[model samples]
Target chain A: MEFNRRQVLKLAGLGLTATATPGLLAACSNGKPAAGDGSVKFEGWDYEATLVQQNLDKFTQASNIKVNYTPITSAQYVQKVVAEFTGGGGPDALYVYDDSLAAWVEGEYLQPIDGLPGVDEVYSSIFPGNAEAMTYQGKRYGLPYYTDSNCLIYNAEILSKAGFSKPPASLEELESQAAKIKSMGLLEHPIGLPAQLSDTWWAWVWGLVFASGGDLFDNQQAPIMNTTDTVTKDVLTWLQNAANKSKVLDPASLQLLPVPVDNAMKANRYAFTIGARYALRDYNDASKSKAAGKMKMALVPSLDGKVHGTISNTRMYGLAKDTEVKDDAFKLLTYLGGLDANKQPNTAKFWFQERGLGFAYKAMAKDADVLASLKKFADPAIYAHLAEIARPRNVLGVAWYTEFETEMHKVVQGVLSNQVQPSAAVASLAQSAETLKKKYS
Target chain B: MSVLTERRPLGDTAKAWALNAPAITVITLLVAYPIGYSFYVSLQRNNLKRPKAKRFIGLDNYKALFSDDAFLSALKVSAVFVVVVLGLTVVLALILALVLNERFRGRGLLLSLALLPWAMPGVVNGLMWRTIFDAKTGALNGLMLQLGLIDSYQAWLTSSTGAFLFTALAQVWNTLPFSVIILLAGLSTIPSELYDAATVDRAGAFRRFTQVTVPWLLHPLLIVLILETMNAFRAFDTIYVLTGGGPGDATTTIALLDVQTVLTFTDFGLGSAYAWVITAITLIISVGYIGLLYRKGNFEV
Candidate 1:
């Protein structure tokens, strides 16, 4: 006996009604204000209120313009902006780095601000050679707001105790000093390195690589790392052997902030380690450590026993592609990136370091207060040292950085763990680099 | 109209198909479309900066991903992460659930408190753990020293193994509450009469637990296990916020890798491919678990 169609319809209706209804899902709760009329929605990370309020107040007082700020942390900033872009509500202004700049550029989430007043001037001020990299397809995507260069932060007390009056002037001298500190039994770590599997490890290692006169990639977008590149091999080998032979590096050195090498240095557990200049302020701000006044900085060793080089990175500002107020946004960029902005007495007095930002404009860099901070705290010699030898990170386009960074860490880890030789690791890295160049480029 | 028996009845096949229509429609729109689109993307050389250069090259992404050490390491770490966190969470949750199920004066408060870890936002929870694990000024090391448990402060999240272990601990702590709540609800459904009958039969506590409680709770246990396993595999925000998958790629997971690919690298094709790979694995595991449970009558209802 065949069933009738009406019976089937009734059965289906009963089954549909029997299932439990799904729960009402709420939207993600962390919502900032949307891009509003007469106000630009800006997203940044780790910008404290007092400093930001002061800077904003001054900018507003000067231009009568207001910005609605939505702050996130450095790590979350990229994710948030990407999400916003993906969702079609990206911020009108963003803070981005050179490493991840390609990501936004590739996504077409940014607008080139070439015609904006003073962009070209702002671009020219940032250590001349670095400017061309910020331009993509003959258009300026971002203006350099501030730049960073890594150098050696040493414990003056430890150095004096070990009979060294100043930081090492060469890689051989640096290693010899590290060994001397180890021999004195005054320190547990001679050098603090970035071994931690985070964003800064590549940055930390790249400095050493550049100082040794090794290139991460060549101009043709091909992998330059091969077994024959002795400089690259030497750099990786030194990091591994330093961690082992010197016995000054803590087993947990990888997990530390580049600055906290100063903490160990302060405690006399380490004599020297690589750190960013901005971190010098962090060291000064630390109330518990004893090395505040006793710390000194120097550049990483270069080839020829000449002035050591450093790795320089710039954080730039850009107008959002979809911003409603192109003129106002450019006005803000001009104020932030131009000489007029840095020369504002209030910008120096109120927001200078309180905002935990460094000076980018030539005028600001030479300001009496800002210059004092750089001269007294940040090593003057190292800045010059980096200027002479510093090279930008390998331009692998956007998709290639993650792979390159991963392979670099593995190579370092392999050497440290004794699982692979440094030369072989370079060979492996070359293979990874080759794969990336072929697939992505 | 004269005879109601003349009306036709739809067959079981038609009825079953009709019942599934809404779900099928929703799944196709929400899940299938994106998955299919991403598969198309994975075969292309798509860069966000150069949209004009997008070109289809089949299987290149998959080939590239295997040779990429970071992607491989991320997958391995993710697997280890899921297994270790799940093992820790399930055992701790069961014990807590059993303890809370007993009659007590502050039972209601205890039950809510047990579930509090699950309620905290992921980023906040991660930050709190990060501070506790900080080398210079973490509460954990400070307290440990005060208590004389260890002489020096250990960098809990800095070394390869240390970061891996502690990140797993944090994940377990964050997820255990959910497991406890689910198991507790399952415990509620067990009849008191069955236990009373067991007592009359002179059955010991262990005997009663094994015979009655275990069998009765099996259904909900299966649900909890499957859901928690999937949740654990997809864990991102907590680890990303806490460790950023570092002292170097030590804590990187497939989800975090997907993030780096999409946001950091702007290799959407590769990122989407990785996402699809994870989703496919999850689907396979869920189906396999359900099949096993059904065959064993663990979820007979």
Candidate 2:
């Protein structure tokens, strides 16, 4: 049958409505209301996801609250989570990086746990540096997932072969020892540190600077590392010389991330490198590392050999500001980052015992089980010593820290690549920080 | 009666519009709204991290971009990247298209294999290149070692020039197949009569290629140039995976910088300004290509 134009138009209109109606209805429908059934949604960067699920299962069994856990890729975790939060849907509780805490708090994506149950105990138990890292503008935002300080990890066999029984105690000694190791044909560029242009790159720089007793910013958030006599300058100069002039630093470090640097250490390609204390676990895991059983952690070398310190970092479990199941979410947060109802640091113990993850709890340092587990992959004494001295970078407290970190990565990269002198690069970074601070303020 | 052939009353016109309403609405919501919203966002100091401080800042974000050293450096990097990738892709694609257009054994298989890189995702392509160019265990170094080309493994991605070249080459590998297909289609459409006439007029092979082939393929080449330019400008996944705009700002394209600003820094206003700048650049380049290749409503040399 031949249809008239008007009839065809009417038929098309009906078909179009028919096609779009379901989608429109779905868009309007709130598929499931959150927080009504004692359930919480948790997210974190992917790292031993099976273990996370097992712990979540334990939490669910103990608390009688169901949890939906999702693991995002670590590299894109912040971007993906921020996008979800911006779009008005995100997990109830999620992992928060210490460096990103200030930005997330400023963005109002996270809620303070200042008045939450067991929060005070959680704060009092963990290391003060980690607690400070989680706090922004006088309010605590989360509890620690794990905390670690950057330590100088060395291949003991390689260093012994190069006629060194102990790790270098100063930056000058590190360079000279690295040069001897290189000259002996044990390894080319015997020092390895990740200088890749990433947010984490600043951590390595800050760790070295802190080890040398340099302050990047004052308490008032003003730049302080611009002067030539500062340890920041000394650290930057050493890094530049190691990468370019002395050539004891592997050029590949400029392209490597933390894991790759660890892998390089495992392969015994370097006599020394700076990595997180926890990475010592993987570095000494015989099954995973060829250099296992020979790797040892040393204090991060400094300029004067008098001050010994490193940059500490923490990853915490934070509550989303808009979480519907606030109580359940807090329970999950406490379970993962603090103590459970039994007052036992079950999650922290599990992570430390299983993965050799550093614990934020000060008590964990003295726990027999934690010490025994630490001895399996790392030296408990060195780990304890580094923990005692490690301090989180002061810049992390500022809202402009992320932007400053990005600029810092560029400046550090510029120094490593020999595009600019360390002095000029440090000055440039200070300028960048001041500009960002002013703009953000 | 056929809908196109039949005359319609004004009431029927209303019916036509009513029928199109759903589509129009969908387009408005999905396409137009974001563009309009982004323009408004670009004009404000809408840093997500500083929500309380956000306010209407007019063209301040755009003005700041002119002085942003990172953004300016990214713009330069993007310019070099687009030029290098486009030149390599168009030239190599034309050569491949010309070769594949000729009758040969396994030509079908060759064409099929040629499309494999294009079929691979950008991230995968990047990973593949990264493995090949990796400093410690890369196959390139291993091959060079075995062949006695170099005594030691080299850090290929460490140098700025090497990183930029390898990244561009990876992009070219991913994009060349599409251009080849386009040029091949254009080649098929080129009437053999033009080639025959050129040959009959005593034009040599090179002369025939210049006189007949080049002129005939201008439209397809124009499409390739415009598309590859935009693709190169907006390339993120491959570069992000490969080098992450690194070593120093060696490979940070405007697109990478834009994402870093928006997501990493959480500065929506500045990021939107970056997005608009990229869009404007892409539009200008596209229009320039069109005008150069097409004139008086027809393809021209």
Candidate 3:
């Protein structure tokens, strides 16, 4: 049909409206009957957008706040988030790891959030790891949405079949148990540790160093990696022996990433593996794992035979200081991170039950229903023990923490592979750490 | 030179400039702008991780490179990777191209098979090789064990030397297909009369190949060498997937190191400096290839 210019313009307008109407309706529906302009944008890699929308719909309904959730791949998101914030436009809030908190704070991308409404009550109520991690210059800059502390997740059935009812109490006993399990041919790699850079073998290195009373550096982030730190060498030697001499560590650990190690545990290739207490929820999933309902959680062995310590990891949601709508963003943060009647945040249920993440809410972890849900999969007591004895996030709180961790992984791998001796690796790392110290300073 | 240049010089040139304006603008925006910005960034002390501290530190980032151990080691690794991969791939591809160019049944299928690795994405190629070289679960180790070649599984990716060698091997395998296709195309262009003349002059197979094939293949060989050298020098994806630039930074080539510095550490200034050094090296090698090609008149019709 031939159309005049007026008719064409009218038809174009109609088409555009038809195309955009659904999105407009969805946006209006997302904003409940709240008084203010209730729109907040969340940007992150870890939590999927649909999952966040599902749980956060309650906030949208109750408070009339609309959340525009955007999920990006972790690597891309981490790099892009900085540019977005620096260029004066970005999401109202962002998900960041503990290592990156110092950088974000240095960049002035986060607001001092401790004074926000409802934050004071829950700020100190979350896990100590979570609480301390969000603090910078003695002021909280973000809210910890979830926290993870290292623990030994063991297959109870596998250990019981090998005549061990409970997991070992110390590294020596654990090594001995691994040897026994190996000798009995009950399991191939009794302790599956990923020596690869992508997974826990590197974290386990730090955990042992901490447990054995070795510090990475002092408050100034200087080079403290010396022979005086005997525990550092001892930990490295023990890991070397486990991997190369005792044959406890799976040789394939050097080749596989985290998923493969987890799968190996489910296939009963391991008696136990070192992982976060938060992850036990997934390890015990009947449909997804063979070790479901047959697993238990215990403290990562105290390598020094005295101190029981483990490294903690926390993920926080930081409010962009430049966000146009600060109140709405603060409300969204509270909705995701603040304590509820059960003291668990909306994300805690989704992260723990759906993704097998652990909760940082101490009261909720001990709450009757939460404990019951946690006990059905893995030991909730392990988290209680973690709450009691675990060291807070002890890594260097420098803007260059990511670089420091990466360099440490290289040094640790060098030692594990016999390419560099423990002493030499430490010496190299000392030099490297000093350079980092100078750079960051 | 033409009458057209003299007849309507100023107006014609103005019209020509106007006509080419869009293309020039596009090239500047897409290509020239990034190159200029990268150089500008290379002059600053800009670690995005320390965004607040960024400043125009001029040449200091370049100076830091000389004292950086990891950067030096990465350059060394990149050099070695380039040499090993380029050497092996060029020789092997030439041989394969020669064989495929010969009269033989199933040559069509063989030519298609020869270019298969080039068809696969770099990530896929790296992962495929990673699976085969896995210490315990790999098919290579399983077969070796079944053959009683060794008593236990070998940790091929654990040691620095092993990781370096395996990463180079994967790189060579991935690049050989492109080199072979180029060399094969060059071979097809050679006149059969020259080979006939060489045979008539009592030239042996090796001698004929050296005297005739080598000379005729020089242009394409140089092009392939230049490209593959640059590729090997800056390879990131395959090495990243296979070894993650590790076993204690043993396989961390300059390209991987640059990426780690820029993206992972968010040290933009230092990362750009790393990039400039790589670009300079690539430029030097490419210039050398072009000079050799032109000085010898390899492109002469």
Candidate 4:
């Protein structure tokens, strides 16, 4: 059909308008929202994405507030988040790790959050140390959500078959048992310890250090890396001894920890591993495990003939200093962190799976399902193990821990590989620690 | 009437200015400002982990980069990667293009199929290759062993040499397709009579190719080579996804170092300094490539 001049002009104008609208809208909305309802745009990696969303939904349903979640990869999110903050256009709330909390808080990028409503409840319910992980400059900047600590996981059947009904009570005894299991040719390593940069590495080291009465740092906060009192030396020596000296564990433990764990429990490669509680959860989730019900949790072996001292790491939530709606954000935070938050079975399960974060909530920790699942897959003594030694250390700055550990990893790996002697490795670690003290300071 | 005509000329100038104004403004705001800010950041001693510790320490970051072991390794990796990837891509693409030029039964299908790898996203390609190279259950190891080509599964990512080899292969796969397509377009432009004349002179296929096809395709090949080289130099996603620059820093590139310095370590000043160094290196290579190409008479006709 032929169109008139007016119709043609009208269609042309419509096309022009459509093409121009987005640009115009972007120009208009550059500094403000179009709807006039002030909205804060938060961006970060989605460690507990859907769970955070579900909690946000709950908060919204309870109160008329909305949150827009922008998820990026962990490393990318930090870069972009810093860019945003530097540009003065960052998200009001973000997901951050402990390593980042100190830096951000020290930078004044985070608001002091201890005074926020329901945060106190979070502080008490989640355990003090978990909250302390998010604290910097003597103020809490994040609310604790879930925490994790390590335990010794052993195959009960394997232990029983080796003529032991219970897991080892000391590091020496643990080694003896490991030797027995190793003699049976059932495993490449009796207690699978991955020397990789995971919670296990820190846990294993920290347990030995704390139990042996070795302080990681001196009173002046100078890094005491090579002291006889420091467990760093003992832990490294023990691992080397186990793998290289005794041949109780495989040499590849220098590369990975979970590999040994997976091989032992799931693939029937070993009888035991000193791993995180999440490993138990992982065991139950894997359908290929032939020794699921046969496994049990125990306190990680103590160095000084006491229960192993554990260090717990928690995933916490903090209100962004730049958040447009701090009150509402706190409500969201509170709702997610509330005692009853995990009461909803689905929400509790969501918390467990999304972050692999253990609960700070005693009730949730002792929940029948949680306990049953832990008991079903974990060695028998793990909960008690966590209770005894899974305390948080507020002394080491989060950022410092990573730097210290990274340097220590080189030393540990060197010792394990026989590239360096224990004393030489420790001496170098001391030097590195001194360097980090300057760098971090 | 003359005044009116003059007014119209002025109006045309005004119209031209208006058309270009927004673009100029956008370039200034988006590109110029960020570059300026990044430069400013590069000169400072800033830490994202400790934002309160932002201090201006000019050239310290630059000085530090010269001493960083990771940065040096990354620089070496990037240099090797770019040169090797560019060389491999150009040669492989030329062969593929030459093969595609001749009329075959499934030429159209083959050409389209060849483009599929290029069409896939970088992440997908990285992940696909990662899966293929998986030590435990990878198809590559399984197939190789089944075919009696190897006795045991190779840990392609764990060993330094193996990781480097696999990473380079992944990069070549990602980049070679673009080279092929560009070279093929150049090949299509070459007169068939030139090839016919070469053949009539009793020229072998290789001689005919080198004498006739290459000179004609030189310009396109240079463009392909330079662009792919730059891309390979900045290859982050594939390396990030596949090896994570790991199995002990075997695959870490300059870009990954810049990212880790900035984000993971929260050392913004150092990161920006590393970034600036990368940009400088890239610019130098780009300029060098252009100068060499021009000198070699690739741009003459």
lDDT of 3 by residue, B37-108 (tens): 999999998887667688999999999899998899999999999999999999899889989999999999
The TM-scores, one per candidate, come to: 0.78, 0.93, 0.90, 0.79
Q: Of 1 and 2, which scores higher on DockQ?
A: 2
Residue A314 CA displacement from its true place in model 3, Å: 1.3
Question: Residue A365: error of model 3 in Å?
Answer: 2.6
lDDT of 4 at B112: 87
Candidate with top TM-score is: 2
Name the top lDDT candidate.
Answer: 2
DockQ, Cα level, model 4: 0.25
- Per the 3 Å backbone cut-off, how many clashing residue pairs does candidate 2 have? 0
For candidate 1, the chain B TM-score comes to: 0.86
lDDT of 2 by residue, A311-421 (tens): 899899999998878888888888888887777788889998888888899988999888888888888888998998889877787888887887878778778888879
Q: In candidate 4, what are the lDDT values of residues B1-301, reduced to their tens digit?
A: 3554433345877888888987988798789988989999999878766665679998988987777666897899888877777778888888899889889899999888877788878789878997798655589999999999999766566555666788888888887878898988888888788888888999998898778877877788778866886798778888877766654455678987777666666677888998898888878877887776655644233
Model 1 superposed RMSD (Cα): 7.9
Lowest summed lDDT over 10 consecutive residues: which window, candidate 2 chain A?
A: A28-37
Query: Is 3 or 4 the stronger prediction by lDDT?
Result: 3
DockQ of each: 0.28, 0.60, 0.48, 0.25
Worst 10 residues of 3 chain A by lDDT: A27-36
Model 3 spans > 4 angstroms off: A1-38, A199-201, A340-350, B1-19, B146-152, B297-301
Where model 4 places Cα greater than 4 Å from the true spot, the runs are A1-96, A113-128, A157-221, A226-230, A237-274, A285-291, A301-307, A322-357, A361-381, A391-441, B1-7, B10-25, B189-214, B298-301
Better of 1 and 4 by lDDT: 1
User: Predictions ranked by DockQ, top down?
Assistant: 2, 3, 1, 4
